[model samples]
Target: MSEKVTVLVAGSWGTALASVLADNGLQVTVWARSEEQVAEMNQQHTNTKYLPDAVLSTQITATSDLAAAMDGTKAVVIVAPSKAMRQVCSDLKPYYHPDMLCIHATKGFETKTLKRMSTVISEELGCLESDVVVLSGPSHAEEVVKRLPTTVVVASHNAKAAAAAQSLFMNEDYFRVYTNLDLVGVELAGALKNIIALGAGMVDGLGFGDNAKAALLTRGLAEMVRVGSEMGANPLTFSGLAGIGDLMVTASSQHSRNWRAGYMLGQGKSLDEVMASMNMVVEGIRTTEAARDISLKYNVQMPIAEQLYHVLFEQSDPRTAVETLMGRNPKNEMEVMKLETWQQWHS
Candidate 1:
């Protein structure tokens, strides 16, 4: 079986996955937008801007040419930021063949149309949306590069495609992959968690103790489930690796850009200032907006995401947002779980 895979964009996550593929003894090619970045990765075997401390595998090469990178590749893993998914997919379309298995690891919604990354990719590639696999979980780039023990899920409506993605990157020593049939759940859980992560970071930045952070994560998961369920995602998927697992990591880890951005916001930094300081994409900011819009469209209540949306866009005070959250009318914790009727779980 051929193990040649092409990963789009040389961001931290993309680079880490490429390294994983290389460690699996597969030939990997990373497509970078910048000629300088491609040259650096090919010749130096290091992506200093993204993964400065980690050295890349010799089997991993890079190219700026999309056509050259896609050539002879059996699988294509796209890790571009959600904002640029459409253009990147458009660029890949000319070189894309139907035989190639398409997977995306990007986590967020397209701002304009508010579509998921898989949807954007499928639209551009002219393939069935369910055929595009989504790879998402708690794994972080910095740790994955160091060969840490990490498990993630690959989901697709097509079982064979999901299994193929599972086999492509699963490594017993460090990386592990699971196959999930709930494509919508996996993708929604992965994207919506970033909003909660931002809230978690804000809690930390405000110097709140573990209690506050824990509360945010708990309620945030509720918000995620509320909107995700309304969007045709399985509620049980929220308990899986792509749901609570991803949420826990993103909301707590220093490697999470969304968390860091939220932290800055909590520390009295303006959205503009915080964004200017960060070199990488902060997915939560955009995800917050998308979630807010989604909640409105689906008639779901996502208080955390809604507040974050106000803070990020309307310049609402972070302290005020926190107080507003705390002052909301008290309700049953299981209120969100009610399906059409108010029957209790133990009923």
Candidate 2:
């Protein structure tokens, strides 16, 4: 028998995951933030506003009331935007059970504290490290909802919690789940990739070819690993599905809001203009700040992340940032390998 799970997803990704779980025979209750979204899910059995074409199964219930939606849930998957996670979880905490295996699918750090999604979940829900989990990978909601083959990683300090989440989402058909014990590495990898995805999008928008994109992604991976290591994450996690896998998807896929935002910037659109046109919150905008702060805090050198930060926040000219990056003194790629080795040997 399939275990029933309750999911809290206020956006398209959450809706998409709920759809996948329901399709796999797990009963799910999704908390829709808006009355309109709730109505569409409950009455129409479809999220017309966000997921217009896909039909949500009747087994998944959508509700506006927080307590009502969370009642009797076996486990919880929180999929709201990172910026909104604190408030949402705070509101739900009165009803959140300590025994619940709380899993987060949202990627991006909390700007004020620079806390990763799992950390935020830990704070808001008052849960111990063992109770928190994160699931991430190179997944796009538009693709995942369509039953496209997608693989994701589930990470937790406690293997039991990770296994619980692994069992909930794994299947032979459209979705697959891999497990990891590095929660910090997984969450940092998930958050940091958005910044690189922005960089990749800029390259594409500037009409740079595959060669340029390949270079950007490669360096981007190095930068992500560098900063993540500084933050005490396992460097090997960067080579896994949560790291390289997510970087590839967010950087190249059209379904990525961060990639699209960076592409618009590359095309010379002002940040305000690009933001005005986007219906969903592009996490890259906030992540750029967190990554920049993390670099300074850890004394890590992340030229690409820093440059993209300037482009996004400081209003640095995209063309100029690109020029500056290319003009930097040429160095051997061995620096990256050396740093990785040092991290492993030192710690």
Candidate 3:
């Protein structure tokens, strides 16, 4: 018998990941909050609101009942949106067992606590924080559902847990999974990059040229590394698949909700209007607020995120935010890069 895995929620990313596990010959059950959505997935094998164009795998199943979804599953993959993670995990506590391999593909922080998704999951499930593997990278759900050669990383402090996650998702032809031990870095990089992606989209919406977008991506990455390192992440992870690679894809892709939200804001739509127009949750909007709080908590300088916070919440004009970024006190480009040089010379 094929191993059973249950994926929480039937959003685009969740549904897409469930398909990957199904393709790997696992009996995958996807839990959705809506009975109507569950009916559609089982009857038509389609989640039209999310993954509209792609047909789902036959090995995949759907249920609105959480307990039914958890029944006999060997692994539980939590892919609920960040805002809903705590409630979802709390609800799953009755069904979650210690022996089950726990993994999360969610990529944003808890707004209330500024906690990572893995932390939230671990607390709700009463499991070790290090035992929760985070799955993230440049892999977009739309592309992944089409089997377009997506690659992602699974990070956990426990090497065994990371390898277990890797084995469950890896496919030679189109889907690939790599393991990394830098759980903090991977989680931080994944969440923080969405903020930069939002800024990237704003640049495009403002009719800015490629040079502007390039600068945003580069500098945005510096901000990510700075905040991530302060939060105990490995600085090198910022240069890897979960960091720069994910940033590139999210900033450039049409599939990103955060980018779309930022683009609309740049085009002069109100935050309320942009959010109302979006059917999906734009993680970066909330994440920007969380990053702002994090910056203040850690005393890290995150000018872009700070500017975005004002633009998003304080009603600051997007153009003025850009100006503020440009007019900041000039600094050397190699400040972050030449740390080793400075240390060696001093030694």
Give the count of colliding residue pairs in each prediction: 0, 0, 0
lDDT score of model 2? Answer: 0.87
Query: What do the candidate models score in CA lDDT, each in turn?
Result: 0.91, 0.87, 0.92
lDDT (Cα, tens digit) per residue for candidate 2, span 1-347: 56667788757899888988888898889987788888878898888667778887898888888888887788899998999999988988998988888999999999988988887888888898656999999898888888999999999999999998998899789899999999999999999999999999999999988998899899889888878777877888999999999998899888899999999999999899999999998998899988888888878888998898889888999989988888999887856644655557457
> What's the residue-level lDDT of 268 in candidate 1?
91
Q: What stretches of model 3 exceed 4 Å from their correct place?
A: 337-347
- Show the colliding residue pairs in model 3: none
* Candidate 3 or 1, higher lDDT: 3
Q: Which stretches of candidate 2 lie over 4 Å from their true place?
A: 337-347
Per-prediction TM-score: 0.97, 0.96, 0.97
Ranking by lDDT: 3, 1, 2
- Expressed as tens digits, the lDDT of each residue in 117-158 for candidate 3 is 999999999999989999999988999999999989999999
